[model samples]
Target: MTAVTDEGPGQVRGQVAGQGPGPERGRNPDEGSAPREGLPKDRGRPGRDWDDGLIARRAVSGAAPQEAPAAVPDDDVRPQVEAYVPSGSPLSPRLDALRELVGLSRARLDRTDLAEAGRVLDEAAARQRLSSRHTVVAIAGASGSGKSTLFNTLAGAQISEAGLRRPTTAAPIACSWTDGAAGLLDRLAIPGRLRRRPQQSGTGGDEALQGLVLVDLPDHDSAAAGHREQVDRVLALVDAVVWVVDPEKYADAALHERYLRPLAGHAEVTFVVLNQIDRLPGEAADQVLDDLRRLLDEDGMALGEHGEPGATVLSLSALTGDGVGELRELLGRFVQERTAATRRLSADVDAAAARLRPVYVAEGWPGLGERAREEFADRLAEAVGAAAAGQAAERAWRRNAGRACGTPWLRLWRWYESTRQPRGLDRTVFAAPPEEQLTARQRVEQAVRTVADDAADGLPGPWAQAVREAAVRGAQGLPEALDKLAARAGAEPGRDTDTDSDNGEPAEAAETAEPGGRTGAHRGRAAGRPPRPAWWPAAVLAQVAMTLLQIFGGLWLIGQIIGVLEPGLLTPALVMLAGIIGGPLVEWSCAAAARGPARRYGQEAERRLREAAAGCGRARVLDPVAAELVRYREVRERYVAVTEFSTTRG
Candidate 1:
């Protein structure tokens, strides 16, 4: 067993598994355990928390503590994300979760903030591939904390200089107990000259530490910025860490705030060592250790008490070798268990999740509503003038009905008037007020805006903007489409006649009968020929018969005045009266018969225009908005997958 010198690191020279000072030579250790630096002398002793911790690993690979170590020679540098994370491993979901997260951000989000996540995953994979047998633990501390001396004591050799300024050697020093750690040291960027072997040859009575690669990091509070940078870099790359703090600088704010606090989640892979505790006077070492625990708690770093689950805390003196055996035995189990890589990676994920959690949308998602869709359709119909078209249709029906059923004299009068002037239903039917037509374009724009807002509501900024853009794209030709829908004459779309047919488009302008249209289009219903009433022919016959009677009676009167034979004045006068009055009665009856049918046809025409307008809107604005909403929900699910891992992990 080996003990340490208080005044100089050189006192332990040439003692690399050779003749080092015994427990009797130095002041008694804080733990009063073995004389050796790492090997415990009080084996099988009661209240030995250090020995109890070495029971066995939690069986991560289903291998016992005595199971053979993995061979550490391979050529894998950069494996695919999935290839590294086997099917049933704890890290399997993390690959997809993080990959999906990054993919979504690049494709849809405004800024992908977690670039470190990639490095974390890559390092995890790279570590897994390198050496399963080895565990690389770094000894980190502020300048003048004697972490280098602690590093040397652990290796059983003066491999690192005690008081060397970090500016002279900005890079970390590495010592591997096993032979296959060259690649691992290379990955840490430790130059070949800085690499050391704990023994001159063989295991050298340190078989329990066979797979340990201990690193002496550059001082954390080094005035040379490069030294601090090196410290940060190596800490990120290492499997586990032992933070060395003397009693004076144990509660240093820079150390806690910059490193420990941020890395609190990694308590499992952490070792908080109260180094140089022999310098504490009286029972003050215990008090200092307790105060350090309090500071760690404030930093959100949990401490393991009575073998509970938390960070491994210990007080040791690299000089007097006090509690040094306890620290080494605990580390022996930590390295042999071989779970540092997994724990470090899991903590990295926890950290990544914390960084991204603030911006995550936790509320239930808002969807595209059916009510919004109907409102959008209604807007489009109004913009296209379906209401006004219905009125025009009714008027057109009346004009056509009058031609079929009116008295011959009245029909002749209407024909004469048509030659002079025609208003509302004059041949080309749809004649909405100019004011209503003027607002059609504005109404269409409003409809698009409203639907876009509804669809984009409650969405993230980039996704919301995407939905709006899709809506705008769909609305590009909508106004023209609506106009074409409503601007039809008295016919259905894409047909030659106002009636149903297989013929081509109308040849003449009047034949086309432009009616249902928006804004610039004729804003009214198509007034194609309306169906004739059943009694039209009968009404024509009766009117013609009355006219003949009037003619006969008038002739009879004229003959009587001319002194022709047998002329009765009462008969002629009654006949003439009957004919004139009957003509008026028949005309009135025909006008009443045409009214109901005319109104029905008008309504049907308007409905067709409205439906067309609605369909156009759905194709243009609503469908695209709906798709965007779907895409966003998909992105949201991906985000959940990414964050779910953090919550579920310890």
Candidate 2:
């Protein structure tokens, strides 16, 4: 049999007893009562009997103990306790280890994880408040809520100097029980002097209230924002809260909507004290308390009497110590309950754990595979090759035309003949005007751009943008690509030879029309002019120099034949001609022969642009997405662990 117990307000404590139906059915011989084997014995002291009764009630209600409490006898009770332990339950140590692992995973994620981890850590810290040994209960309210007055009343003296002046408490003041445990003040970084409380001789021993650390924080509604900030900072780190509100402003929308509502999850560690209750008419106090309770409930606070182990709403006059005894008694009982420390610590840990969870979460992203990268590289290379081929072909055509017909001296004549005068030549053979013709260089550039644009198409959002940018860059590099192509073409200057003017032919009529004379007359006149006797014979002898010219001409012809027949010279010249003229022809032929390869290369270049775009996309866009995913995973893990812990501990 399992016995369950509800300890103060929200807590449930359970105890399991009794074995399953056993062979021994005999009753206890000494007591002569029904067998005690399966019955729960009430072992609590007289005054504490309610706790045991509650445990029995919880057990009867089927709320089994999560783990066997130390007091259960081992002989028969151990097996029953084992049976009651839930299967697949994660022990506290296991959960802690898992949380640590989650923390480590979060650390590896980038900036998004860092921010998320910070938030998770904050939540875990808040949760730890539930289990802290020393409770730093801060009394917070607007000015004239008698917060300082309440602080003094709680401390049993005029510890905080209260006045009508606005923002009277400039800084925080702490009061602690003198006989309480030591080190808590030091842990909180509070100096020993600030730990003083007003000496009080009481109906209840003051020593019972030891371990209580009460703080009088600055007013949250002070005109100075810094005061409010300080109040907020202290509130976050404190173990619990005592929200002091006067009857008139107990339901202040700003206070409830802003502070109270947001902190609804911390209700287990909160108390609402309606201070200055004496100001209300005697009968109205009860009504005001009820209203306050209802408001707190609306804000998700559970309210009851003190020592109820949940949130409580109480009306009191801090000035006159009205209801102060009940408050002291409740606080004393809470102090005596050692689990308060564990609860506060656990709560803080939970909060911090939550903040850290987002840092550990893992998210998936769209990634380009290795095959895609290879494909992109190949495409880019092919695009560049095609551009090179086109440029080479154009260059070859230009060189061949220049060698065959162009010259510096005759260029103007050729231009005039081709343009204005129709020399019985085909007009259709002329090169296009610069405006109409796309240069080899321009063609390459356009091709590259086209390839890039095609590759960029159909990509996802930011990736598409990246692909477009990469394509632009690749296209802009086309001029350099063309220059490489031209270098590889290796077109050299062609040989130039002029026709001889001195042929043994008669002068044309145009030539003979010299300004001086007709051709025959000129010749006869030249013949009549010279007849010097012995000197003329010698001049004729000197004029007959053809023998020397003949000898030199014969030698030059022999040298020409020798050069033409030499294998090295002939082979090189032939090869040069083939490359200059044939290279472009070959490219054009290949462009026709292998159009598939050329188009494929162009497509490949586009693919490369897409890949480079993907890398850039990861850097700019995917990184943030991955980080967010990491955060989400971390949060989910912590949320799971926390809910699990809450269930186990319930």
Candidate 3:
């Protein structure tokens, strides 16, 4: 009773033999000599000499045939044996999950590739996965290909009308196994009722066959292009395709070139059922299948038990039910393999995710640079100050002028105290030459205009225009502002004295007159009376000559005695003569030298007032604008730095 070891192919064979239920297994002598069960079974079948030719030639050339190593006994624990298998190693669940994910990704990519043509490939893929309980095998082919008859035979009823009609099955007809699984039909949006059949006897041999859903779509080569589109669209989403062709049209270039050739990669999920084989003789059916295999091989689909070369090929008559059971059994096996749906769904998701990648990319806004903001701020400040400087200078000038030309009473007090004598009215009032008289308002207006013009020079564009206009408006307001300031400053005591009569006569009259006579004299002066005569000369001149003679002469003592006797009359006469001779000459000399300098001084005083007013303009208006500009510059710099930091990090 030697224990059977699960090691080499011979050991597997011995185990199978021991487990046999019949004597035929022991009666077959070659059973023990057969290769392992995993090797391809039909490798030595007749007329399959294509693979055999390569092997035979290799053998004839005396090449040493390489053999696979014998499987080691599970009990053998050699040093090189990293691990041992309790039974045959099964696929890891992780590997299956990875494979499913890869398949899903591929399906999604395929859907996306087809999406540019306005088709929702992913939706089709999802619908296919959801309807997996049914085997949605579409029979796609050109017109007159006998697809309707095949559909009727597979359905086991006269479901499709097959006749000499020009076009048939304009829309798809879906047939489901169970009544409730008609939900599958509703999912397809097919408007057909569930026609229940008594459970057919042979349908339940394979449990996987119990829930199969079959769909019959419109012809791909129908005159209506929409029908062809429907065929193509349904083919992409279905679980498996059953390409039904007759012997004549099986080799039809249009069918093979347009659909079958391009869909070679989908061979695992495809089938080619050569229909109306009853029309071909027994030998022709086999010959046609052989030629079809050769064609499918050329198209990269290899035939095994499947109707497709790489897929399954079945030669059957829908009218006679030949080979229909084999088709059903094959379909059942395919349905049992439920992993394709998961694989396809995952692929679709991955592809859709890839397409949405571009939307997630982030962008930032452009910002003003720090240096540019700083430069603009500096220029704005300068422009503001320049416009205001003129007003400031005007204010300064008016202050100096007002102080210089203040009250004559103050001047008189100073003079009287210094010389111990009362000062004349003319000398006190007319002192300091009347302050180059002009109003502070007038000075400010002129200075504002000049300063504004200077500030506005060399500016360009809209900002320049804005700055110029603002400066002009600001300058125009300065005169009024300065007038107000001056009015307020000069509002104190003694302002009337500074503003009174030019020569002090009116003031002297006001001081000397009695109250009742003052009104009469003011009225008389209002009538423009002639000024009084300027005579104090005769007595003073006579005294001055006598005094000079007593101090300096004895030779002219007689002349001195005569001078003393008639001093009053002679002095008066000589004084009148000197006035007559020198009055015009003195007036001319004084007027000639003083005219231009006096005019210039008056102009300078006006100019200074204008400048002070301009400075006031800057202080009241432009300085705020400058402060605002500085704030703007600081904010702009911070904004630029933030944007720059974002860009660098990105």
lDDT of each: 0.65, 0.45, 0.42
Candidate 2 runs further than 4 Å off: 1-102, 105-133, 179-183, 186-193, 201-204, 304-309, 348-639, 647-650
Q: Write the per-residue lDDT of candidate 3 for residues 208-295, one digit (tens) a residue.
A: 5555666777775555555655565555445567888655445554455456654554566677987766656447677767777777
- Sort all candidates by TM-score, best to worst: 1, 2, 3
Q: What lDDT does candidate 2 reach at residue 565?
A: 39
Supply candidate 1's per-residue lDDT for 417: 58
Count clashing residue pairs in model 1.
12
Badly placed stretches (over 4 Å) of model 1 are 1-86, 110-114, 164-169, 199-201, 204-208, 279-310, 353-363, 398-410, 422-439, 486-490, 493-521, 525-527, 530-603, 647-650
Candidate 3 Cα errors over 4 Å, as ranges: 1-121, 128-132, 179-183, 193-208, 302-309, 339-650
Taking the tens digit of each residue's C-alpha lDDT, what string does model 1 give over 411-522? 6665565556534234342344556444666788888999898877777667778889999999898887776765553366322223212111111234223232232124
TM-score against native, each model: 0.71, 0.42, 0.35
Candidate 2: tens digits of C-alpha lDDT, residues 169-241: 7767777553332344443444554555534422334866765778887775565556655565566556567
Report backbone clashes per prediction.
Answer: 12, 48, 34
Candidate 3, residue 17: how far the Cα is off, in Å: 57
TM-score of 2: 0.42
- RMSD of each candidate relative to the true structure: 13.4, 24.8, 28.2
lDDT of 1: 0.65
